[model samples]
Target: MPYSYEPHYFEDLDVGQTFESAGRTVTETDFAMHSMFTGDWTELHTNKEYSEDGPFGARIAQGPMTFILSTGLFQRTGIVERTVVAFLGMNYMDIPNPVFIGDTVSADFEVTEKRDLDSRDDAGLVVIDSEMTNQDGESVFAGDMKFLFKLKSDAE
Candidate 1:
């Protein structure tokens, strides 16, 4: 049967459609947990004294953590939950601003492109322009992500 609720099938999304996910504070706990999980205990992300003397003037969240949080925020939006078949890849990933503890960040996304898949008629590709921004509107991370989404007919 077709999906009973609204879910973004491949054909349901349109280029230029934009969405912003809810904001979440990046706490010290979040930073620490991410560090432990990834074994990325870089001074910029973990050592306050070291970072205080460094470029950002204080410790900052890990880039990968920031990216993960941004994606999680967007996932919480529930727009593509069950409809997405796979994450194809990412391009042009960049971190232009530091994300510090206590900073509130939100995920923003825009549908930039959509195309059919010749090998698999049941799915299509969707290219999304994604970003994470702090409360001050400085971008924390930005990238273009490609997703394979099941066609509407497959929802049944």
Candidate 2:
């Protein structure tokens, strides 16, 4: 059986098409959960005393946690909800600032490139430039996300 749904096809996306997701505040539970899940309990992220003496002057959220949150934020936009086939890769991922507990965060994305996949009639590729920012509009993370998208023309 085949799936039936309309999706943003390769032809529908433009280089400048942009999307933004709702904000979420980073929480202590988020840090605890992420730490238990990944065993990444570095003092910079978990121990207040250790971090107070560290560079950021406070315990900060893990870098990967911000990445995961950003991805979740982008997914909430429904831009690729049903059209995505696979996550191809990410490029130039950089975390320029720290995400502290209780800080509100949101994700912003723009379609930067799209190309037909000659090998796949039903799908194409899209590259999205993404950034995750805090309440102050300072970026905590930025990167390019590549994904395989089901083309609308081929879904029917």
Candidate 3:
């Protein structure tokens, strides 16, 4: 069934409520593409033989790759389908664990703050505490992201 994208009001997102998104598996090509794009040929990610000597004992995806995958997973969450105005920026981004090829990744989010944009009557701002976890359910990345979106008509 086709789903109608409901416009979520800024005030409707409760502070403790959680939102999750679909997961994705990292692949060899993903590593290659990222390496090629950034010219990051660090053996830990691009050289299988060299990586074998590392803790993972195999070529692991670059930490930034996990960060990128996390963004894709975050987008799959329908939260952005609502009254999103714009993505402002991110803060405290960190990767605490190594993400390897074939490992799946997903995103979890909690609304941290919401405030009215005094100058813009139609929208407000929201800050979400976001975390990206690997298939093992370990938090690999975390940060806060800010967005601008339409305000709820009934919001105080």
Instruction: Provide the overall lDDT of each model, using Cα atoms, as 2-decimal numbers.
Output: 0.85, 0.86, 0.77
Worst 10 residues of 1 by lDDT: 1-10
Q: Candidate 3, overall lDDT? A: 0.77
**Residue-wise lDDT of candidate 2 within 1-156, one digit each (tens)?**
111122476777888888878788999999999999999999999999999999999989888888888888878777777789998989779999999999999888898999997899989999999999999999999999999988888877
C-alpha RMSD (angstroms) for model 1: 3.7
lDDT of 1: 0.85
Candidate 2 displacement at residue 122 in angstroms: 1.6
**Model 2 segments beyond 4 Å from truth?**
1-7
Ordering by TM-score:
1, 2, 3
Better candidate by lDDT, 1 or 2: 2
What does the lDDT read for residue 109 in candidate 2? 86
Candidate 3 residue lDDT tens string, 1-156 = 111233456866666667777777888889999999989999989888899998989987777777777666656776667568788888668888888888888888788888887788887888888888888999888988888866767443
What is the alpha-carbon lDDT for the whole of candidate 2?
0.86
lDDT of 1 by residue, 57-107 (tens): 999887788778877876776777888889888977999988999999888
TM-score each candidate.
0.92, 0.91, 0.80
Going through the candidates in order, what is the number of backbone clashes in each?
Answer: 0, 0, 0
RMSD, every candidate, angstroms: 3.7, 4.8, 4.0
Q: Candidate 3 regions off by >4 Å?
A: 1-11, 152-156
Error of 1 at 91 (Å): 1.9
Ten contiguous residues minimizing lDDT sum, candidate 2: 1-10
